[model samples]
Target: MTTDARALVPLPRSGPATAAGTRFRLHRAGIQNVWQYDEQEFAFGDGRLLLRGKNGAGKSKALEMLLPYLLDGDSRALDATGTGRTTLAWLMLDGFEQTNRLGYLWVEFRGTTDGGDHRHLTLGAAIRASRSTQKALPTFFVTPLRVGEDLHLVEGGKPLPVDRLKEIVGSDNITDRAVMHRSRVAPELFGITDATRYRNLTQLLHRLRRPTVGDRIEHGGLASLLSETLPGLDEDVVEKVARNLHDLDAVRDELGRLERTDTALRTFLTSYRGYLSGVLRTSAQAVSRELEVLAQRRRAAGDAAQRTSELRTQEEESEARLETLREEEEAARTDLAALHDSHAYRSLHELSEHRSTVEAVHTAAGAAFTALSNAHGAEEGAAERLADGVEHLGSRLAELGTEHRELLTQAEMAGLPTGHLGEAVALPRTVRSQTVETQLTAPDGETHTVQQRSVVRVDTATVQDGLGSWQLRPGHALPDGPTLASALRPAPQPGCGVTAEQVERLLTTIALAPAAETAAHDAVYHDGSWRLGILSGRHHKADA
Candidate 1:
C-alpha cells in the first residue's frame, strides 16, 4: 500500500505553445506634396530619434506621415493632427489649384512577435482631389501590397495607380478598397492581430511630437498610450467599464428630468390650490349673504302668514254679514210687495190721481179767466163807442124838434096839416146792442160759430152737477178720507227690515271685503308652503 507521493501528485503539465504578442515599429515614411514638399523621406532610428528643423521645414509633416501606417491608414488620425485628409490632398496638389496631381504616403514598418521573429511590411496610401465632389473632396486609396516570402510586390517610392493597387489586393483580400487595411494585412504577413495595440503605437508617435506638460497626462498622452498598448491589460474589461459609465450617464440624465418634473408639478399644484381656495372663499361669502337674506325673508313670511290668517277671518265674517243683509233685503222686498197689493194702498193711489186732476183743472180755469178778462175789456170798449153814437143822435133829434115847430107855423099860414109831419119825423133816442158773429176753424178742420154776446152766461145746472162731483174746501186740510188714504199708502220698506244706518254699515263692510280677500290671496301665493308647514324655512333659501 505504500504509494509514491511524487507519483500521486499531478505531473507538471505543458500544452502547445501560443504565438506571442505582436508589435509594430516604424522604419521610414515618404511624402510627396505638390505644394509643401516635392518628395521627402523621413527615417526613424532606434531609441530616441531627434528631429531638428526650422518652423516651416516640415518637421510636423514628417512626423504626421507615420499616422496612416500606425493606425492602418485611418486618415482621421491625420485630421486629429490638424492635417485633414482633404487639406493634405489639396496641399499635395499645390494649394488646390493643381487638383489633378496625385499625392502619395508610404510607410515601412517592422513587426516583431514575442518569440522574436520579425517581418518587414509596407503600408501605402494615396490622396488626390475628388473629381466628383463640389469641394474637391480628397479621395484616399490604400495601395494594396502582395507580400512574397521576403519582399513586397507593391511598388515603393512612387505613386501607384489606384486601379493597379486594387487588382493587386484582390477585392476580397481588403475590407475596404479606399481605406488602408494594414492591421488585416499585417496578421497574414507578420502574425499581428491587436488593432488597439497598433492604434496605441500611432498615438505614441503623436504624443512624442506634442508631449503633454501637466502632472496627469491628458487624453491621448504618453501614459494613456502606454496603458492601452500594454499586453497585460484586459480589453474586454475596459470595454465593459466604458459601457457601464455610459449607462450611468444616461441614468443621471433621467433622474435630472424626473427632478425637474417634480418641481414643476409642485409649482402647478401650489398655484392651483391657491386659486381653488380663493374660489371657495368667494363662494362661501356669497352663500353666507344669501343665507342672511333668506333668514330675513323667512321672518317676513312668518309675519305675512299671521296677517293673512287674520284677514281670512275678517273676510269670513264680512261674507256672513253680507249673506244676512241679502236675506233681510229679500224679506223687506216681499213685505213692500204685499203693502203695494193692500186696499188702503189702492185707495191712496186713487186719491193721489184725483189730486193731480184737480190741480190740472185749476190751471186750465186760470187760463180761461185770463181769456174772459180780455174779452170783457173788449166789450167795455164797444160800449163806450155806442154811448158816443147815442149822444149824437139825441142832439140830432133836438134839432128835428125845432124844425117841426117851424113847419107847424108855416102850415097854419098855408092851411096845411102839421100833425102828420110831426108823427112821421119822430126818431128813438136809446143805444141798441149789436151781435157780432165769428167763424173759427178748429184743429179737426171744421168751422164753428163763435157769437160775441153782450153777456156771457153759465148754465146753473151744469155748474151744480160739476160741484157735486168733487168736494172743495179752502183754508182747510185735505179731507180726512184722502188724508187717511194717503197715510195708508204703501211705501218701499227698508232692506232687511233694517234702518238706513244698518244698511250703510253693511255697504261699508262690503267695500272693505275686497281688500282683505286680496291680502289673503297674496299670502297664499307668496307664503303658502311655509304657512301650511309643508316645507322647512331652509328650503326657501336661494342659491348663491
Candidate 2:
C-alpha cells in the first residue's frame, strides 16, 4: 500500500484549483537515492514545507529533482551550490567510488474540475549514476501515473533495471520527453500558459526562499502573478499602460525643445523691429527734405509765370503798333507810286539830262552873233573911208576936167594929143558897191534881223526870253510864247499833286519799311520814328 504525504503538511494553492484552470494541490513528493535518500517523502502544508536533515542528506538534491517537474524543466532552478552545473542529471548525487546507483523522484497532485470532479496524477523520473564516470544519466521514463497504477515499481529495495525501464518508455524518447512532459503538465497544474508568466512565478518562488532587496517585487511582478493567480485582472492592459508611459515621455521632451525654439524666434523679431524702425525714420527725413525743395521750386515757377504774362502783354502792344506801321508803310508806298507817275519828277529828270545841250547851243549862237556884229562894224568903217576917197577924187576930177576942157579947146586948136585923151574919163567908171543882209531864226520859226556894215550885233534879251520858258524848277511858270521852249517844258513840277517835302518823306518811309517790320516785335513807330518799350526787354530802331 502507498502512503499519502499530504496528511503530514499541505501547500496552499497559488491559484484556482480546477482541472482547466492553472491550479493544483501538491499532495506529496518522494525521492529514492542510493547515496542519500533511500526512500523519502516530503509533505506540503498550507504555506510551506520543511525538510530538516544533516549534511549530504540530499536536502538540495530533493529540491533539484522536484524543480524540473515543477517549473517545466527550467534548469536555472537546479543550480548546485559549487558545481557550476545545472542539469537534473548533474544535480543527482554520484554513488560511492566504484559503485553504481539508481535514483528517482515522484510528485503527486490533485486537481478539481469546474464540474467539481477531482483528478489525481503522479509525475515520475528515473536517473542512473556511475562511480567511474562520476555522472548521473537520466532515463526517459518520465511517465504520468494514477494512484493504483503499478509501472516500473519493484517489491524489495532493489533498483528497477535499465532494460525494464526502456521497455516501459522507449530509448528514442530519452532526448527531451521528461522536460517536454513537464511543460505540458504545467499549464494544467498552474493555470499559466505563457512562458514569461511561468518564469516570473518560478522566480517569485525562488526569491521567496531567499529574500533580498534586489529581488523585491515590482508592479510588473505583481501584475504577472495576479494575472495568473487572480480571476479578473488582464495582463495585456498592464503591458499597454507601460508602453503608453514611454511614448508620453518622448512627446514631453519634443515639446520642451519646441518651447526653446519659440523663445529664440521672439528674440530675433525684437532686434529686427528696432532695425526697421531706424530705417523708416531715415527715409522719412529724406522725404521731408525733398518736399521742401519741391516747394521752393514751385514758388520760383510762379514768378516765372508772372514774367511770361508781362511779356505776352508787351507782345500784344507791339503787334498793334506793327499793324499801324504796316498801314503807314502801305500809304508811303502808294505815295511813292504816285511820285513815280508825277510829271514834275519826270520833267526834272528830263531837264537835268538836257542842260548841257541847251548851254552849248546858246553859247554858240552868242559867239556867232558877236563875230558878225564886229565884222559889220569894220565893213561900215571901211565903206565910209572909201566913199570919202571917192568924193575927193570926184571933186579933183571935176576941177581937172574944167582945166582940161580949156586945155583941149587949146589943143584942138593945136590938135596934137586930143585924139589920145579920148574925151574926159568919168573916174574910171566908179567901182561897183553891194550891201549883204543876214537873219537869225529861232526854234519857233521867228526870225531876228542882223545887218553888217563890216560889223554884226546880236539881240541877247530876245534869246534869253525865248529859252527861259524851258526851266523845270518847282516854282517856275510856263512860258507864254510860241517857241520850242514852250513845247519842251510843261507846267513846272507838273502831274505831281504833293509837295516835294511830302514826296521825300514818303520815299524815306518806303526804304525803311522792311527793317521796321522786322524789328516791330518789340517796338512801335510813332510820328516818324521807332520807339521801343521797356517791358519788351529790347530796344532797337525800326530802321535798324
Candidate 3:
C-alpha cells in the first residue's frame, strides 16, 4: 500500500525529431490519482521509456496502470507482474478506506504527416473504483487534443465525469463502451478497415499482456495479425502462384498423355507412309483448288468494296436529308415560340385549363352529394331501429305489469306474503341444479351407495318490489320422530372402515328423542334433519 512509483521525466533532448520520420512513437503517458501517485507525467525518450527502480519502488505497478490498460482499456490485462490477482479496484482502493476513487492513465504518440508536418494522437483511459460496487469501471478515449494544452481529463482536483469529459473533448472522441473505443481506435490509430481483424488484434494484445500463456497462438492468428500489419503478397500474385502450381501438375499429366499419343501416332504413320505419299500428291492438287477459291474470295472483296462505296453515297444523301429536317425543326421551334407569345393562343390555353378545372369541381361536387345521400340513408335506418327498440320496450313493460298483477292475485288467493321484500321472493323461469351420488366399497368387497342430497338456494328479495309472492321457510323432522338414533348410521369408505369401538362411542353419545320428549332438557340429538329454524344455511358468516 505504501509503494510509490517515481515520476516519468523525459531524458535530456539529444535529438530534434520527436519520432523517426513519419512513424508514431510514445511521447507522453502518466497516471493521475492512480495508486500511490496523485499526479505524474512520463515522457518517452525517442520511442522508448525506462522504468528502472528497486522491487517495491512501484515501477511494475506504474506499467500495469499505463501500459496495456491505457492501450486498450481492458482492466483484466492490467497486470504487469503476471499475477492473476490484480484488478483496477485493487489498484485504486487497496491502500485506502475511501469508498470511491478516480484516476486517469494516458499515452500520447508523436508522429509526422506525409508532408513532414507534426501530428499527435492521445489515447487515454479513465478508471474509477467504488467500494460499494467492489468493481472498477474504465472509459477509453482518443483525441488529437494534448493533455494540459487543448483539453484536460481532470479539473479542481477531481476526475471529470464521463459526460463532462465528453463535453470537453467530444462525444465521438470519448466513450465508456469498450466496443466503440476499440472500433474507433482501430481505424484512427491503426488504420484497420475491418472490425473482425481489429477484434483479433485486440484479443492477441489482451492475451499477451495478461501474463498468462493460456491459449496457443495458432498460425491462423499470427497470419492474420501479420497479414494486416506487415506487407502481404498482392492478391493477383498469390492467385497466379496457386494457378501456376495447378497448371504445372496438369501439364505433367498432359505431357505423359501426349507422349503415349505420339508413340501411337508414329507407329500409325509408319504403316501409312506410302498412303501418305499419295495423299500428299493429291493435297498438292487441292492447293490449286484452294487457289481458285482464293480468287473467288478476291472477287467477293471487290464486290464488298463496291457495296461500301454505294453505302457511303447513300449515307451522304441521308446526311443531307437530316440537315434539311433539322432546319425544318428549327423553323417549327421558332414558329412555336411565336405562337406561345400570342395573346389569342394564351387565351385558348387558359380556357382549356379552366374547362379542366370546371370538370374537376363538378366531379368533386357529385362525389360530395353522393356521400351526403349515403349519410342520409344511414340516418334513416338508425331512426327506424330506434323506433323498433322503443316499441319493444313498451311491450316488455306491459308484460311485466301484467305479470306483477298476476303475482299479487296469486299471493292473495294463497294467503302468502307479497309487495314487500322481507315477505316476498322471486324465481326465474329456469333453475339450474346439481346432484352428486357417491358409491363406497366395504372390506367385504360389497359396494354401498350413500344417499346424498344437495340444497339449492332459492332467490329471495331484500328490497320492496311488486314482482312476486313469497313462501314460509321449509322445515323437516327425522324419519324415526322420537327415536331418531335408530335411523342414524355411519357411512364408511373403502380402506377406512369404522371400528366397532368408534360406532359404539357414537351410538352412546347421541340421543334419539323428539322435540316434545327433550324440549325442557338441553340435549344434542342424532336426528339427521336437526334444526328447527331455517332448513338451508345462512349465506353470511356474520349471520351465524
Q: Name the candidate that leads on lDDT.
A: 3
Instruction: Pick the TM-score winner.
Output: 3
Please estimate how well model 3 matches the true structure, expressed as its whole-model Cα lDDT. Answer: 0.62
- For residues 406-470, what per-residue lDDT tens digits would candidate 3 score against the true structure? 54554343333443312322222222334446574543446755432333332222111212222
Per-model root-mean-square deviation over C-alphas = 42.0, 42.6, 55.5
If both were scored by TM-score, which would come out higher, candidate 1 or candidate 3?
A: 3
Query: TM-score for each prediction?
Result: 0.30, 0.33, 0.38
Worst 10 residues of 3 by lDDT: 520-529
Ranking by TM-score: 3, 2, 1
How many clashing pairs per prediction, in order? 1, 25, 0
Model 2 vs truth, CA RMSD:
42.6
Model 2 bad stretches (over 4 Å): 1-22, 46-48, 52-58, 68-70, 74-76, 80-95, 140-144, 147-149, 166-179, 191-193, 196-200, 210-544
Scored against the true structure, residue 388 in model 2 reaches a CA lDDT of 51
Model 3 TM-score, 2 decimals = 0.38
Candidate 1 residue lDDT tens string, 431-506: 2235677675543346756564432222323322322322223443232433433442344253324333433333
Q: Which of the two candidates, 1 or 2, achieves a greater TM-score against the reference? A: 2
Worst 10 residues of 1 by lDDT: 535-544
Query: C-alpha displacement of 378 in model 1, angstroms?
Result: 99
> For model 2, where is the 10-residue window of minimal lDDT?
527-536
Q: What is the C-alpha lDDT of each candidate?
A: 0.50, 0.53, 0.62
